[model samples]
Target: MPATAPRRRLTAALAVTAALTMGVTACGGTTKDSAGKEGGATATGSADPKAPLKKGLTVAYLPKQVNNPYFTTADNGGKKAVEQLGSTYKEVGTSSGTDTSGQVSYVNTLTQQQADAIAVSAQDPGALCTALKQSMKNGVSVVTYDSDTNKDCRHVFVSQASAEDLGRTQIRLLAEQIGGKGEIAILSAAQTATNQNTWIEFMKDELKKPAYKDIKLVTTAYGDDDAQKSFQQTQGLLQEHPKLKGIVSPTTVGIKAAAQYLSGSRYKGKVKLTGLGTPNDMRAYVKNGTVEAFELWDPAQLGALAGHTAVALESGRITGAEGQKFKAGDMGTFTVGKDGVVLLGKPTVFDKSNIDEYDF
Candidate 1:
């Protein structure tokens, strides 16, 4: 169900008061109701779709974790976008990337603070639904990025890339490295991660293609997005499947950890690794031959897009409905897709040749 309308009215008033206390201007002008069917628009019944969100609204970005390099970089992008838009920007999250319970508490706190919007990378799609639903009802525009929450709980999801694209890319890369024929395994992040599961499902579908028939999937292991745990899991995979020739770790943490484990083992030159990873984290491994190539979207760009989406939702420039359009600052204009999702772009393949071109 959508957020309660009466509750949003109360929360909006409280948010305006909070904004005044902070010496920030609150949102003005009429806004469409939760159903996107009332108020807000010109005399001709049209809205200025490219207008910026109201100035001075507070936007809090809550990543999956605080210290993780990936989230840190992404949050920094969000901070830059928010500040540039003349809005208050704050970031808060758990130190452990896999802590869903901790993320819930943080969401509740942000809602209590009456933030204009809360952009988050959920640890689990379902675990944070209640808190996010409450946040939405409290007039906090909820936008999920990187990892998403349930559809009913958030206004929009800024996806890094299409699930089918990411899945096909990772498997195709692995197939090339493994000579298109060998036993391969998957080293995934959290088992319940919505994005991870979606990509993995598509990957499974891709493997069914005739070109990949020679490649056999040995097993899939969960890393929980922890370095130590992922490292240990990689070791376990090697031990359990001595003939494993390749590994696809779609999570940044898992990919880095798997590369580290492979770098020192007898499989250094034997086992091939590829997945979604930032160039910096995988640079050394790529140079030393532990990893040949991997794919990932620009995380900073993803974050900035999410930030822009949050503001757009709060300001009513565009409701989270399919075909609604809005401008996202320098990143250009975007249109809301099915299920309230906004795609950043396609993933870029990072290899030794192009790794130097990317700083993040």
Candidate 2:
């Protein structure tokens, strides 16, 4: 639901991510209530949408994991938009999605480079706060996409869509696939990933409804956003819960890997699987009868919007205030909602019938 980061992935290396203790609630979250609180680095001037977008500005992008194909797609989209707007675009980050130290270091480096702005997909909600606040204090605008930092750390956050929407939809999709009665488990990315955790929170809340009472949540397994690890986790889930009716893997990496395991095993077709995934990654599995459908927004569109948001911030078009709006190039106008968030749009469901129409 976040990115293709299959391009929606993060990792167990939460251990490596500032050595953060691995637990969803223990670590800080990027909820709007907290991000909306005043006091942190922010744009103080009023927005001027008609102001000429300043050219030749340096905008940096730091994705969660550099090598993931989905992130690569999202970054390229940003590069395209930034260049179109007459700004310079470059990317920097660690190869590992869970490298919190690398992420922090890159933020510091971007600030030192005197970059006009930085677009990041935070690895941890709070671990990167100090560094990000320092950047804001240095007059560098920070915009987060895909995942978010605490509202206090950055000037703006570009989310794929509402956290509640992404989370609740996964549960609905799985219930339909499993006939509304059976065991289900969530396969997630890093424990500290704000996006993943937020979506999971809504998923759990949705399950509390009477419509989903028949469905029992068995457990949530962490795959650390690694292919082999995800595959192993899927296999283990089945081994441990022979009655497991379905799996909801929110990250592209997790869903694809789970699809891979189910495709080759006896569970193929018998077990339902759904979550965020890129069309290309899931096409084979969908054709093979391992999965019925999955969901994601165009990661490129998400990145491009972020690029425009960053440029707008530097150009003084908006100052991260609720109700302020800006045009995102050809994508259209977007409004800054609560917590300085700009949502890309709703999730799109891709199945065998329409998967071919999508390429990214």
Candidate 3:
């Protein structure tokens, strides 16, 4: 959540006068009810599509984590949208280290609060499917931002770019730094993550071209977005592959962890670090010489766009289709794809000269 609200006095009219004892729910969950629809858009007792979004129309944003500055920026974006739209939007999540259970609990809580809509940066597309499906069943409009959820449940996905673009950009960045011909290693997030897997596969295919054949990718490892684990993996790469010239981490946490480890070591200038990292996380590394450059999109803009798109869908303004343009406040106009998907644009390469200009 953005900031916790202290408990306050409640009028008797609004109070739970009769304290009915309910069983202890799971961590991060709320009391459940079964009288709701499954994956469809409309629910029986929900607010009408044309109903004006009032001041307290709650919209919840659940991200992969809350500690990274990237998600913080995204929260700020959602906040701006809330202010502009005069609605209630809360940004909440586990601390990057937790499993999918906490998010499940969060979804239950949103359902209890009867949120107007939910925008999530899903940790696992599969694990969160049941929870999201349940939420949608209970009259919540579901949208995924930064990352994605299972296709059947989510109404819209705010994509940052295609995996092909991400993988190609990282390879191009490393090749630019290492003169295009040397051994490279991939330090990825997890084995099952959809985004990372797709990007890595695209990177592998891109490397087989004539211009990139000279650039050999020696090894690949999973860091699971753990800082210490990523650091150890970086060290192991240095030890095991003496000729390794670069390491690419498709996940933000793994990229920053690897960059932090390389920034302080003798390999600072030797093995280059490039992947999907925020400007704040990699600012020092880019300025010092540990990383020549890295790639990422504006995640806050992504969240905000997702919020607007979900509202639009709820209001019957647009359907999920290719070439469908829509306005995203402060983030400018965006087009919808074949799957109600919206791209936030290409990966931006940040360096010393331009890093300080971007807050996220």
Give each model a TM-score.
Answer: 0.87, 0.89, 0.82
Clash pairs, candidate 3, are 1-92, 28-105, 37-137, 74-300
Tens-place lDDT digits, model 3, residues 1-360? 111112211122111211211122433544333223235322222223344433555677777766555666666666667657777667666775346788777877776676667888777768788888877766677778877766776767888787679888898888888888889999987666667777888999989888987899888998877788888998899899988889988888888888888888888888888998877678788888888878787766666677777665555444454565666665677776766577777777778867776655
Report the candidate with higher lDDT, 1 versus 3.
1
What RMSD, rounded to one decimal, does every model reach?
Answer: 9.3, 8.0, 8.3
Worst 10 residues of 2 by lDDT: 13-22
Off by over 4 Å in 3: 1-55, 319-323
lDDT of 1 by residue, 1-360 (tens): 001111111111112211211222343433323424221111112345755568898898888877677877777778778888889888777778778898888887777667778889988989999998777766677899998887778888899988889999999999999999999999998888889998999999999999998999989999988999999999999999999999999999999999999999999979999999988799999999999999898777788898898888877786677778888887888988888788988888888877876766
Q: Which digits, one per residue and each the tens of the lDDT, describe model 2 over residues 261-345?
A: 9999999999999999988899999988999988988887888899999988888788888888899987889998887889998
> What TM-score quantifies how close candidate 3 is to the native fold?
0.82
Each model's lDDT:
0.81, 0.84, 0.71
**CA shift of 228, model 2, Å:** 1.0
